[model samples]
Target: MPVLVFGSVNADLVFALPVLPAPGETVLAPGYATLPGGKGANQAVAAAQDGAPTAFAGAVGDDALAEVALRGLREAGVELGRLAWVPEPTGCAAIAVDRAGRNLILGGSGANQSARAAQVEDAALNPDTVLVLQREVPAAENAALILRARARGARILLNLAPAGEVAPEALRALDLLVANEHEAAWLAGQLGCGADAASLHRALGVGVAVTLGEAGAAAATAAGPLRVPAFPVRAVDTTGAGDAWCGVLAAALDRGLPLDAAMRRASAAAAIACTRPGATMPRAAETAALLG
Candidate 1:
């Protein structure tokens, strides 16, 4: 089985500071680094590092920063045959992390917004394929991809981050939907449903996983609800935790792990990612050790 990530790739500018700057207040960062990231790229790297056969489809600009975004993905063994080169500048994210490990992010869409639907559908989707998606790209493109994947019987896993409208066809096609607490609430409102995992699942008629940050994560399913406690770890930078979770979960599922076991493994991976400085992911052995 293969996991295909149809998402964005970005060159991340990370600023480590004592505290997040207040409005109209300037704060000097103590450390800074440029890293490869983007919800899609991060997830693809996470899945590949976790020992899954992963492929990534997206666009990057023809610029120096583009190499920064592709390096980590290639290092993690993700196939990038579908990544497109466009005229726009590469997408970027300016991230500020405080001593408490919380972060504030501002994104430059650039090439991400320029991604085409054809690039995503270029992959050979099938029943054994898992299509990982996020909101960083255009929703309409995602919607079209969902339809194409569904028609081919590929499993669809959607992460509704930075929540917004999803086409009804795409919503109904999802095999699983992952969201944080705030995103869950926003999705529920958008779907005209109650603001809870169960209601959202019922409304969308799919499995729903709600990430509760430090508290943990819960999922609503046909069998019933499942909950996994967050692994206790010292926080360093929480920038890519959710993306780690989404990627690991998709990998676990593609490897034939049961849903509960997959969620637990994903939780551990996310916790480990929280202990790192950027969107870096652990190797398969490291993640397995954390699961134990």
Candidate 2:
């Protein structure tokens, strides 16, 4: 089965500093770098690197940064046949990382906002496909993808990051929902459900995974609730950790691993992601090393 990611692609600018800036505060950075990022792009790279046959469908600008994003995806062996070239600049993220490995980010939607409802095609979907989606693209576009995938019987994995109002139709179409702590709480409030993974799963009639950072993750599966512990690792930068987990989890599940085993691989991949800077995804060998 192929994992198809429909999300944003961005060029991430990272500044490493001694401390994070406060409101109206200025900080000096001793290190800087640029990397390929975006919730969709990072997950696509992570999935491909984690040994999944992955494809990415998103928009990028006709700019140098687009080349960077494309390079990263290609290097990770992600199929790019469905990627769109738009007139706007590639999406961008400015990240500030403190010595503690915590980060603050500001994103510019740029060409991501150009993803349209018409971009979805039936030809790209099938029952064997795992459709990976995120909120980085326009809501209507995401909804259209969900509808198309649902009609084709493709399993939908929706990563509701930076969450807000989601269309009920889209919500109902999801087979799985992955969210971080904050996003999960907000989503629960919106749906009038309790702030637990099991409650959310029961309310939405879907598998729910709520990531609790260092506390690891909790999931409500058809079998029952499960908790996976976070792997211990020295932190460098936590950027894209969630993307790593989501992508690896999707790939592992597509390979027919049970949810518990899949989440273990996802946890290992995420732990490795924290040891690197930017949105760098570990290769299969690297994750294997971590798992050992």
Candidate 3:
């Protein structure tokens, strides 16, 4: 099985701050560092690091920042054959992380807005392919890809981060939907359903997984609800933890692991990511050792 990530890529500008500033308040950090990021790219790296046969389909600018944005994916062994070069500047994210590891992120779409569903080849949508998507790109493009992948019998996983308006048909087409508490609530409200995992599953007619930061994660499926407790670890930076969970979960599932087993791996991967700085995701061995 293979995993295909259709999403955004960005060069993350990370600033380490003592505290996140309040609205209209000014805060300063010692300095900032550029790192590979973007929800789509992060998840693709995570899946590849988890040992999945992964490919990334997206667009990047010809700017110098394009290399910075793509370093992780290339290093992770994610195939970039579907990547396109556009005239827009590469996407960038301004991330401010406090000493406590919480983060505030502001993104500039740049070249990411040019990413299209057509970038993914028809051959990429097959029964053995796992298509991973996020809200970082245009909703219409995602919807188009979702419908195509569904018709082709590929398993589709959508991480509804930074939740916004998505078509009902697209929601129904998903094999699984991953989201944090806030995103889950937003989706539930939009669908006129309860915010609980079971309610979401019922409303969407698909598997729903709601990530609970400290407590852990819970999933709702035909087998009923399942919960996994968070692995105890010292926190450093929580950025990209959710992306790690989603990617690892997709990888685990692609490897034929049951949902419960996959959730455990995803949880462990997320915990490991939290102990690292920036948007760093843990390798498969690190996650395995932690699980053991």
Could you give the C-alpha RMSD of every candidate to the true structure, in order shown?
A: 1.1, 1.1, 0.8
Tens digit of per-residue lDDT, candidate 2, span 146-265: 988999899899999878777888888898899998999998889898978999999888889998889989999688999999999888899989999999999998898898889889
lDDT of 2 at 258: 90
| 10 residues in a row with least lDDT, candidate 2 | 115-124
Instruction: For each candidate in the order shown, give its overall lDDT on alpha carbons.
Output: 0.91, 0.89, 0.94
- Ranking under lDDT, best-scoring first? 3, 1, 2
TM-score against truth, every candidate: 0.98, 0.97, 0.98
Higher-TM-score candidate of 2 and 3: 3
For each predicted model, how many residue pairs clash, with residues at least 3 apart or on different chains? 0, 0, 0
Candidate 2 C-alpha RMSD relative to the actual structure? 1.1
Model 1 agreement with the true structure over 206-291: per-residue lDDT tens digits: 89999998888999988788988999999999999999999999999999998899999999999999998888887789889987
Q: Model 3, range 236-258, lDDT digits (tens) per residue? A: 88998999999999999999999
In candidate 3, residue 3 scores what lDDT?
95
Error of 2 at 278 (Å): 0.5
